[model samples]
Target chain A: MSVIIFADQFQGKVKKSALEAVQYGAQIAQQLGVPAVAVAVGEIDGAELSALGQYGATKVLHVADARLNEPEAGAVTKIVAEAVAKENGAVIVFAHNFAGRSIAPQLSARLKAGFVAGAIGLPDTSAGFVVKKNVFSGKAFANVSITTGKKIVSVMPNTFSLNPGGGSASVEAFAAGLGDADFKIKTVKVETVSGEVPLTEAEIVVSGGRGLKGPEHWGIVEDLAHALGAATACSRPVADSGWRPHHEHVGQTGFTVRPNLYIAIGISGAIQHLAGVNGSKTIVVINKDAEAPFFKAADYGIVGDAFEVVPKLTEAVKKYKGN
Target chain B: MKILVCISKTPDTTAKIAFTDNNTKFSEAGVQFIINPYDEWYALVRALELKEAQGATVHLITVGGADTEAVIRKALALGGDEAFRVNSDSQDSFFIASQIAEIAKQEQYDIIFTGKETIDYNGSSVGGMVAELLGLPFVSIASKLDVNGGTATLKREIEGGEEVVEVSLPLVLSAQKGMAEARIPNMRGIMAARTKPLKVVEPAAAETLTSIVSFELPPAKAGVKMIPADQVEELARLLHEEAKVI
Candidate 1:
């Protein structure tokens, strides 16, 4: 038996989350004493496929299908299932992103495997396959034990650090006989967010909220984000007021972000808002009100006017960067 | 067209989280339960809109015990034509999906709608598993959806941006924030909801493959290190030297 990792890519470029999944799968394989094999579908670079070895993949199964570029869940499931059968895979791993969220459950249903999504840590095989995951929107944690012969897990992105080592994987072509039936969902158009780091993949995030007052004052948030080379996010109220797009909203009803550093500016931390961001490695809150509730959850706090403190913080960051 | 919208009940966002029975069960005392916001605000509202726009029948379904009827009545008040409560309290995603899929297969719904994920478990698994069981195409995390004749178009968030996709009828979709606006039940709707049919059906045989061993709250934060406004630059120094994140 082997461990199979689905290495997801976007437009032929492998995502950093995919490498994190590879490392996670390799560790699981080590615990089980099995080889870890990563399966890459769609149009990806050969060099990128070989680099999977650095993240602990012993071999790479490349399904060079152009149609997979816009992954339809059904088609990708068929391909991943074929790879699993070929490798005699006992465990399947996916990065719990868009692709994994869309495909992993279908795969579990198809294979009748016990599946876990948004897993935050490694499985404890000593007592069956128990994995920990955030529940109640990160307010609590649940240790779930999968009691199936075959198991599937989707690791939350940024949960595991990527450690590249010295190695090269042997790439082999695998044929997945997919047809028109599997391509039921057709992509009509793609509009990608340009020139900005996506919040889910961002290591550092600078977020704003209602305390910023209006959309016109958003430059301070952007300035700090730019200085930190981080992505910009907002609380739900700011998005609801049209100060920012709904996609940039980070809260219980919006995106859940687990960045290395999260700076909440001009925001009072409501329970809903904290649910989405409490998983960040470090939290810094800046608010004029000392009892804003966000300060309680913050690692660092500066009670000051956003109008004055944010620009100064931006300047401080810029000065620290020597620009 | 007939649409089946899946509903789930979750604790209110502000409710204090606690566990009982050796951390295996959520403590419901003093907690107010509401229809999961994603379901009430997005999936069910969108289905109700489709019912008005295209003369479609919107049906609600939930996999829970008899106590969930109150939550189902609330959904019915929001304009669902009818609702079914599967008589099972299984929290297992696969088993829950199986029960729903069984009903959908017998009823032959042209559209299956669900929230992207329930706020309580945040699994995001049921919709896709239901679609797989019934051999239907599944589109997830759809922010926007429009239908024309037998074809449906949807907009969903990708890693960086959004993509527009098209699929034929008899499919499944999981709705997110941009799908629709939340609607509050009017007094008339509340009165009408009392007379609406809420059928409780027996659950199909399905195995629960996973079980929760325990639950734990996140560690409490060490008190915030308050810094003076003038020493804002020290925040940067601490982030760089102490936190080492920069």
Candidate 2:
């Protein structure tokens, strides 16, 4: 039996989180005294698939099914089940990103395997397999024990460092024996805002709240974000008011990020907003109100008007970076 | 069309999360519970909009006991026509999915909607599991969804992108942000909801696949180091040299 990692791909290219999953699975495989293998469904670059070995996969199974390219949960579930059966996979690892969140549960149901999502650390295998996950947003933590023999773990992105050391992986094609009837959803088109770092994968993020006043003042947040080469995000009110797109909203109801550095401008840091960003390694809050709740959670606080402080901060970063 | 929107009761976004009973149980005392924002804002609102436009019957469903009835009524006040409370504590995502799937199979709902995940548990698994159990197409984390004839158009958030997909009716979708705006309960809607039908159903037998072994609070942060507004350059230098995160 081997540990199978779902190496997620975007338009035939492997993503950073996918490599992280590979490394995680490889680590678990080492703990289990078994080989770690990766399974990629749909179109994939063979060279890239083989490169997964660098992240610890000893072998990569590429299921080049055209129908599996789109983000369809059912079809991917069937394919993963087939791959698991073929590889005698005892444990499956996935990066707790969009694709993993979509497909992992369905696979768990199909296989009756216990599943854990948003796992922040490696599993504790002393007595029984226990995985630690974020609960109550980021305020609390729960250690879950999976009783089932077959298990699925979706590791949170940016939580685990990617350690590349293994050599090349042997890539092989596996037939899913799937038909057109396997997929029912028809993908019409994909529209991306494009050219901005995804919040989940970004190392640094610059976020704005209602303190920025209106959409016209977003340039300050954008400028700081550009200066730091970080992703841009907004609080829930900003997204709800249409001052920014929902995708840029980072809060309890929005996307959760664990960037290395999170800079909050004009944000009051409500409990909900802090839930999403408390995972950041370092937090900086800039607001005029010294009593703003955000300052309590910030590693560093600047009590000033964001409109004035943000531009000066941007200039400072630009000057520091010599850009 | 018949729509089923799953609502989860969660602590108010501003509630100070606390745990008691040796940190095994979430402390409910003094903590205000509300309909999960994702469900109230996205799933329920979208369903209400569909009901208004197409004369569809929207039903709000939750898997809990008396503590959740108020939240269910809140959902109805926000615009659902009816409500159902599965009379059992949700054991886990699998058990919750099983309960929902059983009702959905018997009722043959034209569409099912749920928030991406509950704020408390944050397990984004129930919708997909229910879809799998019911043999229906599942679109997850859908930011935008529209129904036309027998087909449903949806935009789901992917990594750094959005995907536009279409599936036929009798499908399931997990609502995310941007699906719909949150609506507050008006006086008329609240009065109307007081008389709305809220049926309690016995939960079907199901086994939880996982259990919480223990709970702990996150490590406390160090006290914030205040930087004067005039010291912007120093702050940047500290970020670069001290925090080493710039």
Top candidate by TM-score:
1
Top-lDDT candidate index? 1
Clashing pairs in 2: none
| Model 1 per-residue lDDT tens digits across residues A153-195 | 9999887878899989999998899999999999999999788
Reference interface contacts recovered per candidate:
0.85, 0.79
Question: How does residue A129 of candidate 2 score in lDDT?
Answer: 93
Backbone clashes, each candidate: 0, 0
Query: Candidate 1: how close is chain B to the reference, as a TM-score?
Result: 0.99
Q: Candidates' lDDT values, in order?
A: 0.92, 0.88
- Model 2 DockQ class: medium
User: In candidate 2, what are the lDDT values of residues B1-246, reduced to their tens digit?
Assistant: 999999999998778878888887888989999998888989999998988888899988899988899999988888899988999886589889999998888788999999999898888898888888888888889999899988999999888888899998989999988888778899999999999999999999887889888888889899899999998988898898899887
User: Using alpha carbons, what is the TM-score of model 1?
Assistant: 0.99
